[model samples]
Target: MKMASFSSYYGSLFLLSLFSSFITIALGGTFNTDFDNLFGEERVDIKDDGNSMTLTMDEYSGSGIVSKNEYLYGRFDMKIKLVPGNSAGTVTAYYLSSIGSQHDEIDIEFLGNLTGDPYLLSTNVYADGIGGREVQFYLWFDPTEDYHTYSIDWNPDRIIILVDNIPIRVMLNRQSIGVPFPTKRPMRVYTTLWNGDSWATRWGEVKLDLSNAPFVAGFKNFNANACIAKQGTSCKGFNGGKNKGLDIESKRKLQKILSKWVVYDYCADLRRYAHDGLPYECRKENLLQFE
Candidate 1:
């Protein structure tokens, strides 16, 4: 028993070392309280459903949104359990924002749900990098029957994406843009379970299985610690920024809720951040101008 206890102790110490050269807690907790401001309590969640939700240009009201005003530099982490089915599209959960002409996005998308031992988990980014660009990586995991924590750490100069404390990809602050690096605005957080039908593939096929349409996914336990940019981070931000979901709402109610969204103007802060594709609809009643 003593030997077993000793092994556990040392194993934990090894993990704490992995977080930072300055950290010493030993095996950082999976999703702790320190990551709250960005994600909030019970931030990400998805529920299994027999309903089919498709968000077109007009009807778009799905998913929850968060802000990055709390902290300018810190980590954003979320733990999720995926919904299953052949119709299941790419599952996305990440933090990003667009204010002014600058845009930044990061994604952890499980592209396919083919029955198998290993599902394909991919990461993509866009920044002032090589092409101001699109870079991707593949991760194989048992997504059909397990929950995993998808995390990202953001410092002033760089951003790091992690899986179980394992750093998967990094984006540099000053990328290779012809001009200055692109992203400079404070971003918002968005988590979604979308069905990417236009380019969705199931066994080398792009067609979706309508019989099993509307697969469910859940996002819960978010940790967001945002600070101002004076401090720096070691991870990189990526491409893939947009909103996806189904809109099943009446016009009057849509206007009621969408008003909160328009209350804060992106025109001054951001040129554009997702405005078209959502599950909720907007009308004259939902329109409000901000000073």
Candidate 2:
């Protein structure tokens, strides 16, 4: 009886420890307030003691910022409220990017719209300066009405983008098939409010109505649970290899969002890439087939 009881007690303790390990890996990293003005210094406002930031865009200039540290891999989250009414021709972009002519980038750009129209969310990935993997969506909720949590879960295996914690799109690592993934370079978080008037709204059909000038966007709760590039080449934990990939629940949410809200998926557009065969990422079933 004593032996059995001891075994049972130790078994329960072991199970508890295992569960706690997973939870720790899932939690976010530090709240990152390390950012500096990238451009239009006068138009950017930092409040809440640097925890929150707001960008203003007027006829004269727009504003932007960049993180002080660069990260190799991990999850990044920010709560943002997009430009309000009649935001046509304006774009509020939050993304991660590296420098140089052939740079790497992961984008989350809000293409403005007229009042009553949903803002178009454009996402793209660039590896070694070769981009064009564009996947666009129309969010189910009114982004301008309230702040929404946007996140990017990036690692060596995949890149998963989430809105309000729900996965919207995912790009898998397909380097074995000659597809480039943004693993070699480290990127810094960046946000910009600028005039993309020529092609932002309805492919330029709608111009920036300066009458509704002085567009503004709000940002707060910036978090970075990532492996800072400055901290040596190897590190363990979630920012490193601890994050294997999305679990079953996240994959299910990704599928639902892709089917319902996705307005444009480059993978399915035959006309755009008639010259070359479909990108290797699209040809493989593993890209979207979660089950």
Candidate 3:
């Protein structure tokens, strides 16, 4: 009887410890402020309140790449619900950069009016603004119909983009010169709605396209690592303009590689394509630059 009692006590303690270990493993167990849900810099509510004014389309101060002050990398996880609207516009959950070089922009755009079939998810990094491509995806169903966790783990060697804890896309952030140029920069977490007339919605009898000017959106859980490497600068420089420092031949080669995308149209397509892909193309384009 004594032996049985001792065994039971020890078993219980062991079980508790095991469970705690699992929890810690799940959370990465480090004291991370990026996961904080507190108000202010941590929890930025998108809705208009009595005190705080609503955010605008301009580069957001903290959320969007308001100039060069905001850039980042690391694991970005967002818990958000899409707002019900005309179902034709785009709501920016976050936008890192718009007009820049080196496929630097990272965007989380929500296309509401896509045939009401699936929600389009774009985790894209366009190079030189017009010359980059975006890896596109279509969710299992209407993400706006429910709340889902969207995330991207940007490591020095690669990037893993996940939707609802399911790894959807992965990219190898490697360069050909025997160097790895991981995406390390200040990124903005934007949540706004936009028009998607050229894209979104394929089978609707009455198409609800976003031909209008603006749209609305909401976001929860916006975070980044803001890691910047010294060598990464030269590689991500203004390799966009013609006759730039990056050999003209190299620039032409880039244009040919970038030709797969129809500029804005294809960028939207990648954003609206099924979840089976997205970051793969962006990563490919990014990788191509290095090659």
The number of the candidate with the highest TM-score is: 2
Q: Which ranges in model 3 have alpha carbons more than 4 Å from their true place? A: 1-69, 91-93, 98-103, 127-132, 177-185, 200-216, 225-291
Q: Please list the Cα RMSD from the true structure of every candidate, rounded to 1 decimal place.
A: 18.0, 4.8, 14.1
Clashes of 3: 30
Model 1 per-residue lDDT tens digits across residues 1-291 = 999999999999986565444321112212222222222223333223311111111013224344423233456766766655443344444555444433555556656555442344555444433222222344445554666788766554556666665555444443333323324544555555544655544434554455554355555556565432323532222221111111333223333433432222222322232554321111333323210
- Model 2: per-residue Cα lDDT at residue 253: 82
Q: Could you tell me the lDDT of residue 239 within candidate 2?
A: 52
Ten residues in a row with the worst lDDT in model 1?
Answer: 50-59
Candidate 1 residues lying further than 4 Å off, grouped into runs, are 1-64, 67-71, 99-101, 128-132, 175-183, 202-205, 228-291
Residue 213 of model 1, lDDT score: 43
Residue 45 C-alpha lDDT in model 1? 31
Encode model 3's per-residue lDDT on 235-271: one tens digit a residue: 2321122111234554454344345422243424555
Cα deviation in Å at residue 199, candidate 2? 1.0
Best by lDDT: 2
The lDDT values for all models are 0.43, 0.84, 0.44
Ranking of all candidate structures by their TM-score, best first:
2, 1, 3
